[model samples]
Structures are given as C-alpha cells and as structure tokens.
Target: MTDDQAYAGTAEGQGPVQIDEELARHLDNKRTELFEEFEIRDTFPDDVLIEAKNATQDPEADIEEELESGDRVDCRDLTTCTIDPVDAQDFDDAISIERLDDGRYHLWVHIADVTHYVHPGSEMWEEAVKRGNTVYLPAYTIHMLPPVLAETVCSLVPNEDRLAHTVEMKIDPETLSYEEIDIYKSVIHSDERLTYKQAEKRLDDETAELHDELTLVHELADKLHEQRKEDGSLVLNPARDRAHTIIEECMLKANKAVTHELQWVRGLEAMFRVHPQPTPQEWDKALREIQELDGVSIPGDAWDDPRKAVNATLEQAPGRQLNKIQWAVMKVMPRAKYMSDPFGGHHALNFEIYGHFTSPIRRLSDLVNHWIIYQNEGPEDHDLAELCDHASARQKAGETCERLYKQFLQEVGLDPHAVNARGLEVVEDEEDAELTEEEADTESAELDL
Candidate 1:
C-alpha cells in the first residue's frame, strides 16, 4: 500500500500522514536504515556521486574571453573589508561603504570572484555543478570549492586583492533602505575583518577598537533585516525552535543579502528557497479548528490574527491533531522557494529584485546566480536552462545525501535513556519488510488516495 493508505490504516484518512515528524522523516530514510555505514558505490549507482564529482572537477570555460578577470572588469580595491564568523576561513562576501553627494552611504556588496576560479565543464566546476554546492556537516564540510580557492584565493579575505562583482547601492540614512543600486565587476582592498559579535559590540558601544566601517555594516544589516521582516519574511529565533531553524535563519539572511545590485538592480531574480502561503483546504481546516475551540470566535480573516489566533490554537491542541493545523496555518502565508522571478520580484521580501549572493563559497547555485548576473550585463545568454537544471538536480542529490546522513546520525545517536524510559524502539517485522524498488512501486499503485 502507498504510505498514504498505510497511514490511513492507522489514523484518520487524511492523505499521506507523517507518523513521526522528528523521527519518521522522508521515505528514503528506509534505505539508510538498512546500511548505516553506507558506501555510495554499494547503495547507489556509480554515476551518482563520482560522475558529478569528476565531471566538473575542473572548469573548461575560457577565462580571458568569457570572464572579466584582468583589468577588464570593475576592480576597485575593497580588501580593507572582511566577513563571516569571527574566525571564518572562507570569505564569500565583503562590503564597501562610501559617502555620496547627498551625504548618503553608498554600500557595495563584493562577492567572491568565483567565476574566475570555477568555470563550466571544468573538473572543479563540474564537481561543484554536480555536487551542486557545499554541504555543511555538523563538524565538517563538503565544500563546493577546494581549500586552495574557497578558503584562500577567491575567499574575499581582508588585505587580499581579488576580482569581484560589486553591487553598489545608495542607502538613505533615514529609511536605511536602498535608493539606487549598481552591479559590476570590481577589485577590492579590505581594511579589516570583523565578526558578527565584534560588529555588534561596536554598534553597542563606541571606542571599542571596532572599525567605523564595521559598525556601519552592522547597522545597515539591521535596517535591511527590519525591512525584509516587515515584508512577511519570517526570521525565526533558532534558540526558540530547533537546529534546522538556525540554518533557515542564516540562509534567509544570505538570500536577502544576495539580492545585490548585480542580480536584482534591474529586474526580479528567482528565489531558490520559498514556502508559498497555505492552501484553501488548509485554511478552511484552521478556521474550523479555531471556531470549535472553547471561547474562540471564528476569525473573519485567518490572516488578521495569524500569530495570535493560529499559534494559540495550535498551542492549546498541541498534539498529533495539531500538526495538520500548523501546516494549514503555513498555507495562509505565501511560499518563498526556487522560482525564476521576472523582474527581480521577491514577493516575500517585498522587493522588486532578489538573488542568492551570499554563501557562494559553498553553494554552486549561488555560483550559477553569479553567472546569471554576469551574463545579463552583456553576455549573450545566462545559460540558465542547463545551470538551473544542474542546480535543481544537484540540490536534490545533496538533500538525499544529507537526509540519509542525518538518519544515520539519528539512529547512531539515539539516546538510550530516552529510548528505554520514553519507549522509543527500532523493531523490524514481516509487515514492515523492506520493499524492493518494483515491489514498492506495485504496492504504492495498489492503493488509491
């Protein structure tokens, strides 16, 4: 039977029910469960990981012709700037601040010159394209770029001279928003490297040895964060939720920051991560749940008191039944995911343009985003058809690997105390027998939703 029908056998007939969200995850977890110490070759086809890794291990694109490397691109020295966690080795991005005619600050987002290092079909490039991007592990990392480039040459480290795609925008002090933006190739001279903590400290107190420019960047980040948060973008507190929440928060920050002058100056760019609003069915369910609750009036509009009405109800009926309700509340909001924006329209960000510019040091999709911005300027085509497909495919593969790995981690790291005391167990039975590919397919088709 299909997972949906199987769930129906046990619970309410509500399509495919996720039995245990935290413990019970994607369907593929079954595969990893069988082979904890997985060897990619043994479980999956040889072409799965090796083929991609070898294919793009080195990029073959002609640098002098396609890329604006030497003196051809905008090479304004911005080495005085530094980025990342206090002791970050990979510098994917840097910022430059300048005063303009109206005394407004012209902020420049300088992304690492990745195109200069990785080109299409190259071993490294193809591997990156195949790998899609760097996968950050709990304690290690599967980088998109080799240490030679990602951590050193193309890292955008302070005091280093490197090529860049500079997105210069005029910021209004009063609004703390961008008035105008310009994107182009440029060189930079970073004055000093600053960490998030160090920068925040400077903002909290003056004369704390923090550079003036560092303080300004933090302030600008706040303004940008506020502007986006006001636009329906949910930036949650990681501490209040789970580990994945932090990842979501950091990625959202990067996604917001990525919409620099180059990718978003003129038109709406695509968003790689978006969770569109809930569906009508889900909204209806939520309304019914609220209406039936004790002393709760049927909200005229679910969007009106989403935080209060929706969240409060979920809190009250915090059980298996509430999971569906939570999902329905999500339906009422718009989804912000990977879609090609026509004119840089990020409806969720409420901005005309947006792109994933940050985290290029690890993500190939961001690299492709850089390529898109580059080609749009004067190049004939952005080659998005191939790049987008590669990005999507790689993203899927990376997710599969990460999922399997996490399942392995979960299985290996199960708490003995919790398992015995709280009654969590791993039991194998004939009914739960491992299904072959064909059997699984047949079993799924046997059941109708």
Candidate 2:
C-alpha cells in the first residue's frame, strides 16, 4: 500500500484550483516554513537527479538483457491491470487474479521493482534513505526518489514490459489463507490502467472490460475484509468501497506474506511494521467515550476487544458521529512505527507480522525491504535499527508537515481539499480567482480514517 493508503487518506485531485497571486504567495511561504520546520528536502541533489535521469534512459535494453539472461521471470501475458486514483501519476503496483480448476484462488501482486534501479551504494538509494518517505502536502509532493526515475522506469505503465517484484500466492477459498507464496523478480505487461471510479464501474457493468477480473477480486477482497474484522482486526473505515477494499486487502496480504517469510521462513532481519496496543485503561477511556456518544453503542461481546468494539460502533454509528468515534479511538492509540524486530505486531491492522513490500517508490522501509528480499540477506554494515528509527521519525514529520500545510491552506481562505483535488493555479487578476467558502464547504467531507 502507498503512504496515502496506509494513512487512510486520499491524495487524488480533479483539476487545478485557480487562485490569485497573493494567495499563491501565502501558500508557498507556508510550505517553505513547514519544510524548514520538518527538515524536508524538497529538491533532489544534482548527482541524484543525473543518476535518475540516466537510469531511465535505457531501461528497455537493460530489461531485455535481463530477460534473456533468465534472471527475471517473464509473466507478460498475465492479463494484468493497474488500478489507482484518477490523478495518480506513477503506478507503483498492479494485480492479476485467476481461479485454479481445483477451486483455490491464485493472486499475483506486481510491485514496481524500484531496487532494480535504486540499489545499495547508488546515489538514488542514498537520497531515498535521507528522505525516508515522500512528503505529500496539499498541492505539492516532495518525492522520496527523483521523479525522473520513479515515474518512468519504475512505473508499471500499461503496455510496457516493466521490471517488477511479483508476489504470487495460492490462496485457499475456505479460510482465505495462503496455501503457497512465491516472491521473485519478473517482467510484466499491464494490459490496462483503471482508476478507482473505473474499477467500480467495471464491477457494476457486466460488459465493461476487466469486469470479470474486478468482480472476482472484489469478491475475495470482501471475504478478506470480513475475515479481518472477525479475527479482531481494527477497521476504521467500515464503509470503504469495493475498489479500495480490493487494493487494501491484497496489499496487506502481500506485505504480511513477505514479512512472514523474512522472519519465520528465511530467519532474516528486516524492517517490520510494529504497532503496540494501548493499555487497558486507555482502551477503557476510549470505549467509555464511544459509549457516551448519542447514537453510538459498541456491541457487548466486542467490548472484550477494543479494536472490534470500535469497528462495530463505527459500522452502526451515525455518519456525523463517525469522525468523533474514530478520533476517540485514535486519541488513545499509539503511533505505529517501523522496527527491526517484529515481536510487537501491528495493532491497527491486527497482523502478526506486517511490513511494507508494495510501495518502494515512496517509502524507505519498503525500499529497504525490497533490497533485502532481493539480496536474500540483511543489509551488512548498516544499522537497521537506526534506519527504522529514522524512517519512523521522518514519517511522523511528513504527517505533521501535511497537517500544518492543510491548516495553513484553511487559514489562507483556500480549501486544502480543493487545492489537493484541483491543483493550484495562479491567476493574473482577483476577478479570476476561483476558491470560495461555498466551494470549500461543498468539498468538505469527513476523512475516512
């Protein structure tokens, strides 16, 4: 999952929001202030940019040689497709699914093999380590890797045979458990790229392209979603649509599979996502707050598991009270961080062992994991714990930067959502200015998180 997905936030936007020169200046100044405060490096170094540019220039030739050398599996004919937000630029992941004759489901998750280009000792890799993760603001993005490389060679664009780290899983239909998991580098050709809206339409229309694939995956995803809740996993967004559910469940499964292999099977150290649970008192405090809400009541049985209680309450709570209930839970929830040890599992996702393997383009932890998985060894001479701490800290800084930037946008009479959906456009005159309070209010909706 991408950082935005992990955060349960959507960075998708429609068009550019036209603003006067004065407001644009204000936004720019606020961004500068936030970047300095967080120590976010917005610009790529000269050497890194040059390296990224050089890497993208000859990917096809290099990929052909690798394919010929038999180092990469060629799965180019797998009826694959990418689903992302409409405004998403570089597609980092794709999915392809099939049902075996034996009734088990076969799922293939293709994540762009960023390690193929940005490896250890490379300029891009060094820079990615420094950035930790991409800093996404309301109308701006500070990429972890240079866009020249990430958006080109690392992107799994349709019709292009791109290099990817594919996670192939044979899953049981009954328990939704993986019967077998295989991770390898491969060459894939994406047949199509569909936005979330398009994916939904495909599910609704029988005649739509990829209808069968989308429908099948959605069915599996729905089952996985319920199974997660049944297994005491915390689901903040009970009403997440089918498209988001498919991507989320699949990515979570893949991430869990990779980390499980690293820790249990390979017995190697890797970056694991660890989310500690709250204390009994903290849970009681949150539960009490939720119970006191006007129309929200946690199921009596679910009270034993705080995560389940929040899930049940959110599902039955009024739309207006949804945010309040979530905030109540979040207040007592500790921040999840990256760690070298997988002893403490992710509390929010309720996974025994979870780490990022999907979005290497934007996350340092995922990138490091990719390198480790490919090398079949831990990073030698590097302090994995220190990297984990740096990534966790940088992630917090990015979140803070985004929050403050949005607050600044609101203060400057611009809707951060509007600017996010529609990028900022500096107009020549005040009469041409676009944003209004009505527009902001109209765009306002409760954050799904």
Candidate 3:
C-alpha cells in the first residue's frame, strides 16, 4: 500500500489508526520485551520449589502447636478481621481492638509469621533475600516465596488457624499514647475478611456484621492519625477512604511498636525503613520552586514541621495540581530506605524508629524482622548493613518495574490525554491501510483531546 493509503484512516489524517486487537498484541509484545530486558524472574528455581514443597508437607509442621506453647498469647478469641484489596491472595495482616475496664483501647495487630517455615540458610530464605519483595504487576505478581507458602501455609486467610507475630498495644483513649506495648508470637483465627470497599460499607451501615468492632477500631485509628499529624508526620493525602485510613494507622503503630521493642528492650539490630529529613537548603530550594511555579507560598514552619508543611501547601494548591505539588516536594526530600542503624528515625513518619513488620509474605525485610522478633537472634552470618543495602536496591528495582509496566499500559489504553502526558511517541504501522471512517473519526477525536 502507498504511504497515503496507510495514513488515510488516522486522526484527521494526522495521527495513527486505532485497532483494539492490534494494540493488545503490541502491548503484549512490549510487556514480554520489558520483562526480559529488566530480567524480572517469573518463577522460583527448582531447588526453592522443592524445599518449599517439603516444608509444606512435613508431618511435624505444627505451627499452631508451637505458637500455643510459649509466651505466645492465644488471641484467637478476639473479634479479629482483615481488610485488604478485594483480589488479595495473601492476607498478611489482621487487626483487633478491645476496650479495657479503664476505657483504654487495647489494639492487637497480627502479621503472618512466614519465618516459621523459611529460616536462615534455607533455599526459601535465599530466594526471598534475592527477590526482596513481591513485584506486583497489573495482571500477575512475582512473589517472594513460592506459591505453596505464599498462598497457603503463610497466608493469614480467614477462619484458618495460623501462627503470627502479634503487636499488642494499650493506648489511653484520650491521648492515643501507648500505655503498654507487647510483641510476641501468637495464634489468631481471623473471624472475617473484608475488602476496603466492604469495610467502608460496614462503617456507613451500623447494621452490618462487625459494624461495632469496625467503628471502635476506626475511631481509635482516627485519634492515632491525629496524633501522627500533630507529631509532624508527612502525609501524602490521596483519595483514601475511611477503611484505608484505619488500616494505615493501625499498621503504622504496629510497625513503630515492633521497631521500638527490637531496638530498646532486646538491643537487637534489624533492618529499619528510614527516611532522612530534608536539610534547610533542600527545603528552601523546594519551597522556592513551588512558589515560582504555582505561586503558592509555604511557611517556614511547614519545613520545620512536616504536618504543617503538607497541610499548608495543600491548602494553597489547586485540587487538580495537588499530586504535581506533592511530587515536586518528594523530589526535594531524600528517599526512604532500609537502614541497619536503629537510632536513625523515619523522618517522614516522625518516629524515633520505624520498621516493616506487617507483611513478611511480601517483604524480606519484614521476614528478617520476624526472625529477630520470634527467634530473639539476628542473622549471625550476614552483614546487617549489606542486607539493608541489597534489600533497598531490590525494592527500588521492583517499584520501577511496576511503574514502567503501568505507564506502558496507559500509553496503549483508550486514554489519549494520558498517552500524550506520558510522552509516548506513536509509530506508524506500515502495512495496515484498511479502516472505517467511523474508526478514523473516533481516533481523531481521542487524539484531539
């Protein structure tokens, strides 16, 4: 076909022709290419799979018995539940709250005890350390553990008796300060599994099952959230529902509690998720740029106090440009990473120490923390600094991979404005010339947008 014929059915004869099937095939090919280019591993090695299978089938594998034997609390009676994404396969964390006779709130956060099966020097451990964390793609995931453990044994599914590392906190109802904090192994039976959507609905409907429990937990979480805000924690406000806020507050408290226990009580060193605060010069540069670009003036206290900074800037920024402003601010701040130094606080959260303790099924750093919490011993053979560096690097690589994949999908999807914003260059198909006028008009209209 002639060039004119090939370009005949484009946007006002200016852009490329549109075909759904062709775009799908092109995207699939691009996905394969990017995966190979990035060397993203899709499956576990034979040895890792074999070891995982044996660990699963071992007759003496009695996690529930082990959890029941020791200082591990039997918290199965608590009206516990998990709130996660609707399609989540691994329920790694669940929560429960109780009211003491003194009107204090007793909160229990249970995280999947993956270290129970995967130990040091094992194939599973080796693979997990190498992978660092699960890489979530749009349609699939590259899990840190094999499917047998990630989906079955270590998954904290509802109604299943499972071993978990629990963080129990007693908070004064008025202050939301921890009255007491305890961390130990525990056995928990999650009473129900609700997605974020379901939890939001339950919050709105008082007649829903576990509505009272959800309400109590949510109220406490709100208080905790307000406390964090007062503490100058940097919060990136997204379109988060109430259920998301509740889950986030509970998990943040649990992570902080675990970090506190490890560093203070046991004097054991573990990998911590740390974010360094911005220097005065860095903050000034960011503030200048934001003011120059958006004409928004952020106060000096906003730099000194992150909560004020976020609140003050968001108040001035237009609703449509909030994300853009946040991105600019993030660019000015140092990135968060895993650090072996327990004293290095998380600047973003405004915590003296913080950790990734809630999702061992997905994060290797959490698994390391779990081993330290449960075994009362750090990894003897490995260098803590080296592990932190490697884990942080792997986590960054996984995040980049996921972001690129999503950007590719957006470029090919039915959103011309997004594609343009993503700066995708359109390549003309050479041989395909036949297209209807309706298709051409549609393509033209989409591109013109």
TM-score of each: 0.59, 0.94, 0.83
Order by TM-score, highest first: 2, 3, 1
Model 1 whole-model lDDT (C-alpha atoms):
0.49
Q: Pick the candidate with the highest lDDT.
A: 2
lDDT (Cα atoms) of all candidates against the true structure: 0.49, 0.84, 0.75
- Estimate the Cα RMSD of every predicted model relative to the unseen true structure: 13.3, 4.2, 10.0
Q: Model 1, range 1-449, lDDT digits (tens) per residue? A: 53212311212222121123434443235444422433221222344335434533543233233345454454444324553443255877666666668878767777776876566555556556555666543223456666667776677755556666666677787786557755667666565565544454445666654356655555555555545444544332212222122223333444454555444354534434433445556556657765664554544443553444554454445344444554444446553444454353543344454457656777766776676666553213335445555565555565566555544545544322222122222234434422111111010000000
Task: Write one digit per residue (lDDT tens) for candidate 3, span 1-449.
Answer: 53212322322224443445566577668667766766666779999999998888842247545754676678889889998765467889999998899999999999987887899999899889888888876545789999888888888877878888889999999988789998878888898887787788788988788899999999998888777777777666744568988889999888888888888888888988887888877776766676665656676666765446765786666665666667667777777899889576777777887888998999989999998887788876788889999888887888788778766765544443322222233335634432322211111100000
Error of 2 at 82 (Å): 1.3
Residue 391's lDDT in candidate 1: 62
lDDT of 2 at 52: 83
Compose the digit string of candidate 2's lDDT tens values, residues 1-449.
63213312333433467899888888888888888999999899899989888878888898998899998999998999988866566788999999999989899999999988888888988899999998878668898989876677788888889999999999999999999999999999999887787688789989877899999998898998899889988887778789988998888888888988899999988889898989999999999999999987888988888888888888898988887888888898888889999888888878887888899988999999999998987666579999999999999999999988887777777787667656677999999888744344322122211
Q: Ten-residue segment with the worst summed lDDT in candidate 1?
A: 440-449
Angstrom error of the Cα, residue 425, model 3: value is 26
How does residue 118 of candidate 3 score in lDDT?
92
Candidate 2 positional error at 380, Å: 3.4
Model 2: ten consecutive residues of lowest lDDT: 440-449
